[model samples]
Target: MTARTFQATNPATGQPLAPAFPVTTPQEMEALVAAARGAARAFAASTPTQRADFLNAAAAAIEARADAFVEAAMAEAGLPEPRLRGEVGRTANQLRLFAGVAADGSWVDARIDHADPARKPPKPDVRSLRVPLGPVAVFGASNFPLAFSVAGGDTASALAAGCPVVVKAHPAHPATSKLAAEAIRAAAQQCGLPAGVFGIVYEDGHELGVQLVQHPDIHAVGFTGSRAGGLALVAAAQAREVPIPVYAEMSSVNPSVFTAAALEANGAALAKGLAASISGSGGQLCTQPGLLFVPVGEAGDAFLNDVAAKLDATPACTLLTGGILNAFQKGAAGHLKAAGVQPLTQGAKPDSGAQPQLLSVPIAQFTPELADEVFGPLSVAVRYDRLEEVTPLLAGLEGQLTATLHATDAELDGLADLLHVMGTRAGRLVLNGFPTGVEVGHAMVHGGPFPATSDGGASTSVGSRAITRFARLRAYQDFPDRALPPELQEANPYGIWRLVDGERTR
Candidate 1:
């Protein structure tokens, strides 16, 4: 009933799942953001207990209706029941994590630096605390509808940090977004919070998203999508007069390096694992292992052959949307025909739109340009002749969300230097495990540098780190005890984490 109610169409069947709603007009978008801004002002000023209560209520509400949420998301996105169900659990867990974090209030990290009055010279005291950064614009991703859409990590973390959200629903899953938005709105109302604490905008085109990010009132932007799309929004935000920080997770070729020793030890088993990873989620995850670097030898060749054959045999499922399917086909074909690239596995040309394939080339042939992600169920195998030949090429790898090193104890010990360098190059370093299973926990850093994300060491899309994006620091200089804010008061009413004179204490 908002100005826009975008329709969701099935990618495989080409049928309308729901009626389309009008795109939000510029004025309507502004009004929605204004409401969120007002809500943010009050929400940020609320006690940590109140904020935590609201977040817990929202999580409980979502969990209670988990089945309906999963079904709606599956209907719109074409994901199978199992994946959707797990993603729904992830979504609720994220909300619950943020709830615990907000209640604890330790993320703010209040600090107080006292003056050296005892010394010959008198110095001024300094006290600081973190404050919410007004309203945020969140652009949902197509791949993980529940975990990245309306009731996703972006909204959860922003709310935990006491910032309001305006979610630009992904066109691929509008119905699911709408349903999730309703649940969040209901929770806000139940908590007696202001209306429009979280706003949902339904728009199929990019124009509205551009407007939302460029809006002067929007303090920051959170996005997860393709490199092209995420970059456009980042550019728009930077172009603003008062530039806002755009935390965008663009692209990553989560390259998996298989040591010669590991291949020699268990080539066949490793090949099967690689096949499953490349084909999982139709190879749609940002952390999907797209590239496999294997040492050139009889065992390596045999392993790659097995992987290629298995990929060809696997049946392709429907992609998230028609646009994604088209892009996948175009990118797969282009990458396959590129210089030095060779087809490893080409899925059977099915009667429907199921295009799943794998391609490979030699290390010398795989250039930095070829390392670019194709965004589908496509994998590239790079054959290395020697360990020395692998290092230089590995060093040239761009910053990635994750880089996996497949090795045994002997192989890992031999590749210690490589592991050390890889830790710096990627936000996450996986050892002998598929990179697809991203666990939501405190230690997880689901973002990376450069094209993987705009900010280095800051997670834009996943885990508790996402909450940091919604806050700014505030200092209280020489104020009366009564005038000091409750969060930064000497009495410690909130009883959260704090740093007193350069020391962390409860």
Candidate 2:
């Protein structure tokens, strides 16, 4: 089929975001894959230092074009300037972080086992090294245009691991994706990398996403989106004869439980924080706390009242897309009308946009299915009679990226057993703070259980650990010096940490 044109409409103003662009035709798609596969061969052969330099150049390009991307993203996504600017910083920071990891040369996990000539029989010398997984298909996320879209974490990490990338740009922020892609393309040219080392595909339909994932030459897939979408892609890849791993960060509730002591101590303040977390970015984060557990009493009602009041005052703003807005409204209405549920407060509907809202349901009626993330500025407060009531309820959680607790040291100690149990349900456990500000550091774990991510141990785009996901280990058995990869050779040129004979050292 001939490719159809796709236009990005501004979420804030309901106007055309920019000029529409035609989707890549199947013929063009084939050529794109061919070029990416060719580039993968060259990129995969580059030294770690060389790849690091290219990544540094890409980060520089992003910094140079930051203003343009921010404007485009703000217009299309209805995100305020402050949030957009921060996201841009995070995006650039991610690229630079990957650059440092690549330059360090330790992500390769070099391991060497010297010859064991005196063994029964003969134990030959063995060495192991990590290598890139070749061309990767990166699916851009709707919410994070810069950090998870064109020049997003998947693209940055894949490049850091010396793998070529073919990105399927999200339609929600097409203009922003295009601008970031331009910067990356310019960086590739300046760095003397192959043209197809970074390819961008603008597709409004799911066919291109399917094609990109199912492409025989693509070695792996990286995705950040909904549970349904991520799972569908995984199934498609598995249907292939040579199944490739799809690292998809999908749905999460990011449940937060307030101990009775915390709730009774500072229910009002906690309610305010919850309001902002639920309403920020129109509640568009995967880590947004959807299920809030509080003790049922006058205190619970007081906390809910404060949250309702804050939400009532929150100004209604446009959602990222009309489709999202529709879904949000439908969901908000559904929860409000659901049995044993009540609306605490509703924001004044902006003359032009949807408003923020808070809804609550009794524990008996708030089933696990109702806890599905609504993807808008809405929250469901579930009241419990005691802390014991929370354990069984939380035990039903499928998977999550974070579980937050607001409690004093003594209270946390009392609930230590519960915290330990909840730890298994999430990748990160937080105390007193909302799970919105995801730090980009060595210790951060952004991916969690089955629904949070296909691989719970997978790192988000933020940390140095993300570099490992794109590389695979290969063991060398009694091979000649020439057969050994340069990274695993006895003479180590790129000085970085290694596990020599399974002992960690530099």
Candidate 3:
């Protein structure tokens, strides 16, 4: 039987791109999983330096082919050249960041305790360290084809943690994913790693994704997409005989609050910034501020008017797919019909692209549907009589990736309770700024509670700590020092950081 094939569509032109990709067959999916499982032990046994070399090599390979990646992403994603180019660099940096983590060898978090012979109940020598969780399955995201897709953070962190990775190429940008996979395979080959150390499967539907998650050999899964998609993968993983962890980054409205004092101080600037943040990238960002809380008064009204003016001037940009545009239109229309919701500004509607929209509603009339993510250049401003009223409303919101507060220094001093509530509701809190830009670093928290991520905000899909999701802790009690992993050995052959007798040491 002939396998069905699919091609990428240029969202800007509504035309199909060349070189259709065939969906992975059931047999092929089984083989890919088997290969990854077969290579797991060898890959896990590899030295941290070896994995680091592979990661660095992969980053370099991607840099060498950066232009090609940006071009393909622009056509398939409808993103501008500069943004796509920056994404290419950001993707490479993510790989290199994990490379540094691998080379350091300290991320394993080794710990040791010496035997105490003097005690009646002698304490035996005990040591522990993190080890790879074997093969991982990754799902590329539609919005971030490079940074969150094949060879993206999830793949980088998993491989850095000494786990083999098999990625399901995102259907939106198969060509770009293929290019990234090629670079990673080349890096694996160059580093003398197994052929199964990295693999990618092409598919346009969810069947292969479900199969990949359910594959017995896949020890963990990494995903970044919608709430429905993340939950689906989470459910599938749980249904397995031995369920694995799914680190899925899903939906977030990323609410922002503006105090009256702050708005009075810089209403126009805040308005401009909010407008840019909302419409940027056609509002596809996970951290896009979908909801805003503004005090009902002259200042708030002026701020909303300025924001509407800015959005009205902003041009309509093509969304990632026709389906996304349609959904955005439907969502916007739904908001307009909701009780007390009024359209603040509506940008010129392009035949194929999304029209930027800003809607306003009173806090009392804010429906749950209004709080839901519309997934395009659309946002809602909820009016409140006083700042205190916003606390209860914010408490009612679902877990968010970020919660931002725009307030003056004096105002912030009085907002302790509000800030505390924001902390509980979101993984990250932004003061006097927007939430669209997520910094990738050691201290960054990209994951959030509940629907924002599947792990109840326990894990992050970005930064150095992301490697921990693909690893498990193991303890050795009274084992020969020579038999222990280098990171956990008495001699500390890796020369990495460790906790010795409850004290941090080398």
Candidate with best lDDT: 3
Minimal lDDT window, size 10, model 2 = 345-354
> How far off is residue 359 in model 2, in Å?
1.7
Q: Candidate 1 or 3, higher TM-score?
A: 3
Ranking by lDDT: 3, 2, 1
lDDT of 3 by residue, 1-506 (tens): 88899999999889999889988898888888888988999999998789999999999999999989988898889999989888988988999999999999999999999889898898899999899999999999999999999989999999999999999999989999999999999999999988889888999889889989998899999999988999999999999999999999999999999999999999988998999999999899999999999999999999999998998888886899988888888777777778998878855233324878888999989888889998988889999998999998889889999999999998777899999999999999999999997888899999899989999899898888899999999999998888888898878877899999999988
Off by over 4 Å in 3: 348-353
Better of 1 and 3 by lDDT: 3
Which lDDT tens digits does candidate 2 get at residues 276-303? Answer: 9988887888888878887788877888
Instruction: Give me the displacement of residue 284 in model 1, in angstroms.
Output: 0.7
In candidate 3, what residue range of length 10 has the lowest lDDT sum? 346-355
Q: What are the models' TM-scores? A: 0.95, 0.95, 0.98
Cα error of candidate 2 at position 303, Å: 1.9
